[model samples]
Target: MKKYGLQLRAPSQQKKAAARPPLPPPRGFQEDEDDDVEREISRQASKNKALKDVEEQHKKALEEDPSVFDYDGVYDEMKEKVVRPRVQDREERKPKYIQNLMKKAEQRKWEQEIVYERKLVKERSKDDHLYADKDKFVTSAYKKKLAEQAKWMEEERLRQLREEKDDVSVAFSAISCDGFFPLREEERLRQLREEKQPSVEQPKGDHHKRGGDAVAAARERFLARKRAKLSLVL
Candidate 1:
């Protein structure tokens, strides 16, 4: 009876029963399991999309290749195409100042060579004719040299005259001061021609009638008279 009393009693005639926990739904465990399954499916779909995106990104990365951008090719190509070629063509290009310096140095060297040759010739000359009257020997040699020099000098003079027929120095320098008339023969001829030619003088104006050919006629007469006088003087 005490155990029975502990259980709640419902009045048979009452339409409403005491509020008991609602009866457990049918297939309650399966409904709970379905919720977990739907959540897992959504999670899996998201993971699959992420994986596909990653795979596509990986494929694109692999396909990307620059023909000669890698380290090994980069170094060799740079050396062959850019670095080594430039080095090979980098000649000993002296700037203008350095070139001028080198030219001066070469000129000095040539002068030194000339001086050395002169010294050698002098030493040889001295050794060959020791204790011999040096001036007499040198004079004889000088005379021989002068004859040889004169031969070439005459040839050069003729050559220059041929090249420069109108050279004032060659013609004028060869002449000595003299009567100088033959040189002025052409000028003399010109003067004679000018003297022989007739000249007319203009007489003072208003000597004749105001209108007529009288002025011209008088001028002709005066010229004729002057010419006759000059002829008488000559």
Candidate 2:
């Protein structure tokens, strides 16, 4: 069993190796995966380079000035940023004529208010008692008129009293001229007839039947009564 010249071989293993097919050429998906890996490696190399540069700059700054870092000293980016002004559209602006009309209207309204205030002040400045003297004069005139009326009434009353006194005196004089007893109205008429006809003689027969003598005596009596009334009036 020492056949060293030929290598020991399994006939099944050799047939399986020959029967296995070669792998297909690299696929589209595999190529895409390879490109992605290459891009990631390049991105990592760029990131490492940036970190190294920052470290070198930091080391150089430390060599120059060895002061402790102050985070508070750093300027805030938001504060340094400039605020943009608001932009206005041309359509938002009013026309010149319309703006001028509005301004004129406001000015007119202001002037009207000023004029109204001045008028109110002038009206307030007027005298409140302008007709005071005239009212006093009218009151005095009315009082004078009342006094004149009262004086005239008092004089009229006095005149009436004097007239009444004169009438009483006349009545007393008439009574005394005849006798102590006041004559009856018929007796007075008879006495007045006798006094007026003293020249006529007494009629012999009935006085009424003596027409001429009776007529003369009656006429004399009428004349005497008329004269008595006239004297009393005077």
Candidate 3:
């Protein structure tokens, strides 16, 4: 059978190794020393030549333009021509009219602030007055209530004193007179016994009298009400 599309081949022979140049023979001690000295001398000479060339160019530039070295003068001129004027313009004061307007605005603002503060103070004072009035009303009402309570207490105390005095008088009256006649003493003792008894059963005549008085009072009240009704009707 024929070989496939591409035939496989062995790798080519390896390339020959490159030959290195032969190194020079070792120099004598004096020769190596002389070579090093020569190289150092050439390097230093070249460096000095480069520095001298730079110096000459700088000297020529200074001669061509004397102003190149006039640093302070140039700086002063630049400041005078460019920087100072711009700074002065930036820092310039406002015109009188503008200043006046600004002052007016500030004054108006201060006046408005003063007005607002006064308003606040007035409102605060009004509120304080209202609070004071409320507190006064409460305090006065409390004091009045306390006075009423004290008056009621005094009235009650007087009523109690009167009751106690009446009781003492009744007790004193109940004591019989010493060394009186037997009949009078007996009569007095009987009166005291009667007085000590509760008066739950009033006399029939007194009861009738009281009932008549109540009836008359009721008749008077009824007449008054009827008269009031008739007046409304009329």
- Tell me the tens digit of each residue's lDDT in model 3 across 155-208: 545755675565444433333222122556777799789989987765557645
Off by over 4 Å in 2: 1-22, 70-234
Q: What tens-digit string does per-residue lDDT give for candidate 2 at 176-232?
A: 543657779999899798879767676535633444454455556556545533443
Clashing pairs in 3: none
- Better model by lDDT, 1 or 2? 2
lDDT of 3: 0.65
Residue pairs in steric clash, candidate 2?
A: none
Name the candidate that leads on lDDT.
3
Which scores greater on TM-score, model 1 or model 2?
Answer: 1
* Weakest 10 consecutive residues of candidate 2 by summed lDDT: 82-91
- Local accuracy by lDDT, each model: 0.59, 0.60, 0.65
Runs of candidate 1 exceeding 4 Å displacement = 1-48, 60-113, 127-234
**For residues 35-137, could you state the per-residue lDDT of candidate 1 as single tens digits?**
9999999999999999999988767765795452377877787678876656655644436568889976854554454455556677788777675665544
Which regions of candidate 3 deviate over 4 angstroms?
1-27, 69-82, 91-234
At residue 44, give the lDDT of candidate 1. Answer: 100
